[model samples]
Target: MEYEAIIGLETHIQLNTSSKIFCSCKADSWFDGPNTNICPVCTGMPGVLPVLNKAVVEKGALLAAAMNADLQPVSYFDRKNYFYPDLPKGYQISQYDRPLAKGGWLEVPLDGYQRRVGIWKLHLEEDAGKTKNENGQRMIDFNRCGVPLVEMVTGPDLRSADEAAAYLIRLRQLLRWIGVSEADMEKGHLRCDANVSVRLKGSETFNTKTEIKNVNSIEAVRAAINKEIERQVREYERGGKIEAWTLEWDEDTQTLKKMRSKETEADYRYFREPDLLPVHLTEAWKSAILADLPELPLARKARFIGEYGLPEYDADLLTAERSLSDYFESAVKAYGGDPKRVSNWLLNDVMRMLNESGKIAGELSLTPAYLAEIIKLVDAGTVNTNTGKALLDKVNESGKSPAQLVESEGLAKVSDAGAIRAVVEQVIAESPAEVESYRAGKVGLMGWFVGQVMKKLQGKADAQKARELFEELLK
Candidate 1:
């Protein structure tokens, strides 16, 4: 019997706030020295009290609104008891029964169709510190302690690894578009833990699931989940029981290793926090947050298709990132050319350049105005497409305008009929044997003649004009 995998994700997005959740320490912990950003409240010192940062709650509300989540009017913090070297406090302050938001769904594109993934809850919490194990000793850094995070739990609605990865890509794009978090997996700004289980096809009950942790990248997430699914299927085939356990992904070996037994919710012993009061988000506050949300990814994609007449594939690529979509719009508005033409340039040449340079679209030296000008040059036959593409590198190096570089480098298209006629006559006079073969019905030599004329013209002649001149002179 075939088995199907059930998958869910717990994605933790670090909120981009100025201060920690319950303290005033700086939230930028990426480059700070070890234990430099900690304070009495964050370090959990004696006789210290915790205070909630209003900005953290506001950012959470903004994300909740963007996700179409039901924001609870009243939510309280609870103490989640656990012991770890990285956790400065013996218990972490989190939301349990009354989370900040619930019952929302995100639509992810899968296999050329849309699938709705249910969001079980999104709650606010504090981040733990980092624990690094060197040669023999373990060092703890409290710099990330007390950092604000919103843990989004998803329902087990995914059946395949591809679906899971697609869901994460959409989720990260939404988070970045809404301006809540960077959601960069490399920097630890966003982290994920995937829970996977497999059962016989069409089974109503779920088999024992294993939680895979420390999957730092999206590709690793898909790989780890698939490996677990295979392992579970083999165990069940051998008539062995699948036990609940926690596992870690070894990226170097491309395998999963058992970490420990999975802990249940009861093991955490959650209770209401005695230090802080329950949060109450007024109706006016929710309305204001909902009003401030920008257009999300899916909505923008639909609009690109409808307004710009772009194909679904082009629209999807353009709307993948907020900055990239903005860049495309700016170029379209500036150039006033065919939107499809601009889309082609961006999706092909511009994206390739960005990837090769290891820079983002926003960070590249090529601005929207410059790209628009280049597209205009190509459309007007002032420069051929090859010269236009090569001009981008020149523009990046010399910081010159497209028109200026074209003139200085003699890269402009040579549309002068007289000038191209001279080169075509020279090619015919130089190659008597080839010319005789062409006259003797070697029709394929027409392309060879055009190529010779273009080489003589230094790639500055319009290819179509050169071809016409070749055909005329040969006859």
Candidate 2:
């Protein structure tokens, strides 16, 4: 029987709020030493009361709205009972039965097709602490215990490891662009747990899934799913029932090892937290937040086509990153509506420099004003496109005025007809054989004479003028 892999992901993102979810401790302690940034409330000290951070809830709702999820009128926190050294209180305050948002979808673009991934729910939760393996001892830090986190659960809509990886990447991009989360997998700001199962083709039901926890990066997520799928396939071939289990990814071995059996929902014994009251959001508040949403990547892609008259491919490329699109627009505004030239410069010159330097385009200090100034020099015939590119690279590095660079570097194009005439005359005198060949209809030799003039002038002579002057002297 042909088997198909079904995958779903639970992504945990730490919000960028300044304070802990239920305390006043700083939330910027992610990289600090263990137990240093903790306070009485976050560390779960005896007889301390929890106070909710209003900003965390607001940010969570805003994120849910961005995903087009259905926001609940009211939601609150609950206690998730568990025993782990990483968790200080042994009971986490999270949303259980009623999440902040539910039943949404995100559209992921694949090779020549778009796949819709269903979002099961999004819930606000407090983060647990970190465990460190220092030499031979395990150390616990309570600094991150009360940090705000939003866990997004997706439906079993992914059919392959590629699809799952693509979904995670797109989701991370969205979260980062919104300024809600850094979504850095290496830093553990964003973490993913994938539940994967295999089923017969065309079957309505799925087999028991093994939930793989904390597959940090996209590559790890794909590898874990693939290894688990192969393991289950082999078990089926041996006439064994695939059991529901929990596995951890072993990066060195590049395989999934059994951690323990998977726990059901009832195992946590979730109950509503008595300390925190149910939070409510009004419709007017929701509408105001909706209006504050910026143009997302998909919408900006369409706008680039319709408003700027750019090609679909260029539009897609520009809108892939928000900062890049912003930079392109600023350049267009500075250029006064010349979309095509701006697009070429952005797609070719700016991108080439960025790629070569291994830096983001927005990180450069070359503003729209600077780009417009350079393009004007090219349009006015003061410099050819090649010289213009060189000037732009200089400005990119030194942040000097275009005019100043032109004067200091003597990069000004030699537009003097008289000077170019003299150089072309010299070239004709030296390369008489090539000039004779050109007159004999060896048209390719024309380029040879023109190259001589350009070389004589140190490439300062305008190429078009050099070609014209060469032909005149050759005749």
Candidate 3:
């Protein structure tokens, strides 16, 4: 019997505010000494009261709005009772029964089609401390404790690993556009947990689902979903009753193993957090926050196609990352709205350099003006295409004008018809046999003579001029 996979993702994103959620301890937990960013309140010391960070509240609300969540006027935090060494308070301050936002939908691109994945809720919560082990003994770092986080729970609308990845990509883009979080998986600022189960075709009820926790990377998330689905299918294939289980993804083995039974809603024993009050959002405040939201990926993609006349595929690739899209637009404007050329350089050359250096477009030193100038030179025929490419590489290292780089590197194309004629004649004289083949209807060999002329001229000749001159001489 065919099986249908049911998947839901619970993504935990650390808010980018400077301080912890309920205390003034710096949320700049990265690159700091262990436990250095902690305060008494964050560590849950006796007699300390938790004060909510207003910035965290605002950012959380913005994220909820960006995800198209239905905002509730009044929301409160709850104490999630649980026991863990990392959770020093023996309970986590979270939301239940009443969360800030709910019933939102994020549009995901799957199988070349757009589908809306339902967001169950986006709730504010405090993060737990990190557990570290040296040799064998476990130690707790309270620095991450009480940090602000938004737990975005999605409905079981995702059907496959590909769809899950698409949803995650879109969600990350939304978070970045709203400026709520850095959403860097490598830094653990954003984490995802998935609930996956398999049901028989046309089955009305869901089988026992397993929760795979703390998948940090997108690739890992896809792998976890696929692995869990396979496990569930195997159990049913063997006529074994599906059972609820919690699992952890082992990065080394690339597998999921059972940890425990799935926790029920009542297991956490959620109650209103006594130290905090219900969050109130004013109409004016929402309006002000809404004004600052940047253009999201989908909107930007449409503008790229409508305003710049870029192809849909190129527009999507250009806007896939924020910095890349920004770089592309700036270059287009700088180069007088030449969309196709900008797209070509960005997708081919710029992306190549970024991938090789392991950096984003924003991290590069090259300016849009410099990139535009280089492209302009290529388009104008002042420098040959290869020379323009070489000049682009030197732009980052030397910070010189494109013209200066061309002159200094002797890369200006030999476009003077007289100068190119000499090289073309030399190539035609040396490659008589190849030229004869071209004259005898082997027209593709024209490219071989073009290459020889370019080589003899040290790649300084305009390739198009060389090709034209070769054809003229051969005729």
Candidate 4:
């Protein structure tokens, strides 16, 4: 019997705010020592009160808008009651009933088609601390306590593991593009928990689902969910019922271990948070926050395809990052030529350089203007294509303009027909045997002749002009 997996992901994103959600302690304690970034307000001490960080609300709203979620006019926080060692407050201050925003969908491009995943919940919450089970003992770190997070849950609209991973990929791109979160899975900035259930392909009613946790990377998410789905299918085939267990993924061994029974919403015992006031999102305030939202990744990618006439592959590569996309647009405008030419240079050469140097497109010393000028020089035959490529490295290293470096390094193209004719004649005179073979119909030797002329001219000669001269002189 064929079975389909019903998959949904709940992602917790750490907002890039300066301070913790409700306290002045540093929000990002990724590098800090245990409990160093904590204060009375975040530490859950006796008689302490919580204060909402205005920046958290603003950034959360910005993400909500980007996700196409409906921003609520009035939202309230709730006390999510749980008793765990890492949760010092004994209850997490989160939004349960009235979250910041609700009801939205993000369009995800799968292998061929796009699927719109509905957002079941999008709310602001405080993060719990970390508990590490080291060698023979457990160590607790509260540095992550009170860290601001926007937890979003997706509907079970995904039918396969690949679709789930694609959703996370696009979500991470959107998060970073909007400048809201770093969304780095390795850094724990963005984490995901996938809930998976497998049922007969034609059945619409839900099956007993188990939740998988501790998947730190997107690849891990894909592998773990796939593994779980297979396990559930086998169990049912043997006439065994699937259990509702919270499973932990063993990334090292590539297996899943039952952690505990899955907890229900009633287990949370959620109630309105008593210490803080409800968030009143006024029209003007909401408008001001949404104003900061930039063009999302998908929208910009579509625009690149429609407006610039770029192929889907080129558009996808260029729009992978916001700065890279913007760089392409600026270069296109400055060059006033084929956008595909600029796209080719960026995807092949510029992207390689950026990766090697650990920099983004915006951080390049070769700005969009410099890039446009270099391509223009190639177009006008001011520099050969090889010399033009060298200029990219030279200009990036010295932060000099393309024209200045071309002049200083004597790298201009030798387009003079007479000058190229001299080199072509010298090549024919030097390689007599090769020249005879070429005239005797070793036509492939034409490329070798061009290479010889280019070497003599120090890669400054136009290969096209060299080829023409070679054909003329050999005849």
Using lDDT, give the best candidate's number. 4
Residues 3-88 of candidate 1 have per-residue lDDT tens digits of: 99999999999999989999999997887789999899998888899999988988998898777799999999999999998887
Question: Against the hidden reference, what TM-scores do the models get?
Answer: 0.91, 0.90, 0.90, 0.97
- Give candidate 3 misplaced runs (Cα > 4 Å): 263-266, 407-411, 426-449, 452-458, 471-475
Give the range where candidate 4 is weakest over 10 consecutive residues by summed lDDT: 261-270
Clashing pairs in 1: none
Q: Tens digits of per-residue lDDT for model 2 on 189-284?
A: 789999989987899987888899868889999998988888888888789888888888988888788899866655888999999888887788
The Cα local distance difference test for each model comes to 0.90, 0.85, 0.86, 0.93
Q: Please identify which of the two predictions, 1 or 2, would achieve the higher TM-score against the true structure.
A: 1
Q: Decide which is better by lDDT, 2 or 3.
A: 3
Q: Compare the candidates by TM-score and give the number of the best one.
A: 4
Clashing pairs in 4: none
Error at 329, model 2, angstroms: 1.9
Specify the poorest-scoring 10-residue window by lDDT in model 1.
Answer: 260-269
Model 3: per-residue Cα lDDT over 1-475, one tens digit each: 8998999999899999999899999996798988899887988888899999999888988888888887788899999998898898888999987898877888887666888899887899999999988989898898899989999889999988878988888888878767789999878878899988889879889777888986889999999899888888888899897777889999989988778875664577788999999988778877887777778889899999999999999998998888899999889889995688899998999898898888888877777889999998888888878877877778877878888878777887888899889988887788878878889999999888888878887877888888888878888
lDDT of 1 at 91: 89
Error of 2 at 220 (Å): 1.8
Question: Which is better, 1 or 4, measured by TM-score?
Answer: 4
